[model samples]
Target: MSFTVYNFTNNDDVKILHQMGQFQVLQWDRDLSLAPWTAQQAWFASQMDVRRRQLIANLDGRTGVTLQAGAMQWTAGQIQATTGVKGAGDLLGKMVRGAVSQDSMIKPEYTGVGMLVCEPTWQHLLLVDVAQWGGSIVLNDGLFLACDSTLQHALERRSNLSSAVAGNEGLFNLRLNGQGTLVLESPCPQTEVLYIDLQNDEVKIDGNYALAWTAGLQFSVERSGKSLIGSAMGGEGLVNVYRGTGRIMMAPMQAATSYNTLASQPTS
Candidate 1:
């Protein structure tokens, strides 16, 4: 019981930008009707000529792919999905973690020969190799998109209570461990991101600009300067501090500011 959607088609606009093992990253270059055809909509589109309207990921046969719940656009061939739960104990732990961290309780796992296409989004898609990330990576809330099935996820809590309260971030962050490729929804393109590698060193950020970091790094919220009074005099309050040896990905612009800019735009 099957049917064809299109009789003839040419994938001239869809170009594969990267391929890692069984994963292929395809970029869609087309004008999409993201909003109704109106003067303001046309103006916005003209002003913001976002060429990379969508990103499609192609999975090879016999491989497994896990994506953010509801991120899948369509699939084909012999593909089967599972709850990605090992047992009731794992289920309960994931449920508790999801409740606290604001992540999906159940992430669907797809296997077999098929093609999984994600919904078109303006957000930049980034493919991160976990091995290069020192085997473990801790992502701030809501950056997850998709990843290979080989990865394992857990929750990492802040070492100190003050870090959670003063840093303006959640106490628990989703930590992905193991060796595989991870897909992330970036607030900006990778070119706009700044990578800082530290060796037994430390860097303090004024705000929550750090997107992801190596799990080996110790993160805390502390005063900008050595002393509290000095911190105040330096015109800085609480700051996000990362110490030890690791790498950090920081965006020049704040994520909240990017979202606010998008929110002000007209949508259909």
Candidate 2:
């Protein structure tokens, strides 16, 4: 199908961040042109480094794309949407996973030759390659946006019970495996994200600042110090720990609050 998206790529306000395979991440550099009343607010937002971004999925007739439910903003050129459920058992599995992970219960799949655009958001958008993570990756809570349908999706359980309770994280995390591009709605921008590669080593984080990590890494929650008294004295109680050989995507700037919390607050 031959079609055109006028002003989408040529517009001065939009900036393309990353594009590969079936996904493209776009950012609105500035939104100060909206109106007189909001111009000052928009300028301040830009100065503070707040970004508004969106993800566009380009689909071919042979390959499909899966997106978080309610994420689709618009589509063009003969696209079809499906629940991506194979059977009753599949539906039950997704429902349980969604409840525990706090993800959308039903992710819709779009196929055919067309372009699917997701709703724009204030949070930063990141494009990840599954193959680069050794063919698999485990995601932190609520980072998933959209992914190529060729990847496999499953739940990865925390290494220990303490991780779920002490780390302030869920017992299960969403995992994607295979060779495909995964889109993430990150709490921080890619420039601020710290990537750590470990070889039979361990890394300890005082808070839930990790965005994603390699799938096989052992994750747990432990005291920050050798003893309880020492931990209290050190002013750190518990920390999220990752052990073994793998990689970690962390955002240290978000130690105090998440982007979602900041975005939800009323702005004068």
Best by TM-score: 2
As for model 1, its CA RMSD to the true structure in angstroms is: 3.2
> TM-scores for all candidates?
0.85, 0.93
lDDT of 2 at 192: 89
Name the top lDDT candidate: 2
Residue 68: error of model 2 in Å? 1.2
lDDT string for model 2 (1-268, tens) is 5888998866898888889888888888866447688788778878987767789988888889999999899998989999999899999999988998868989998999988998888777889989999999998888898899998889998889864686577889899999999988887888889999999999998887899999999988888899989999999988888999999999868742366665664332
Q: Which ranges of candidate 2 are over 4 A from the true structure?
A: 255-257, 265-268
Residues 1-268, model 1: lDDT tens digits: 3334341123665666666666666655544545564546555544554434333445565458888887787876677788899999989988977887757888888887756677766666778999999899998778887888899989988778765776566788889999998887777776788899999999988877788999999888887778879988999878888899999988788662244455334333
Q: Go through the candidates in order and give each one's C-alpha lDDT.
A: 0.75, 0.85
Question: Given candidate 2, what's the lDDT at residue 238?
Answer: 86
TM-score, candidate 1, is 0.85
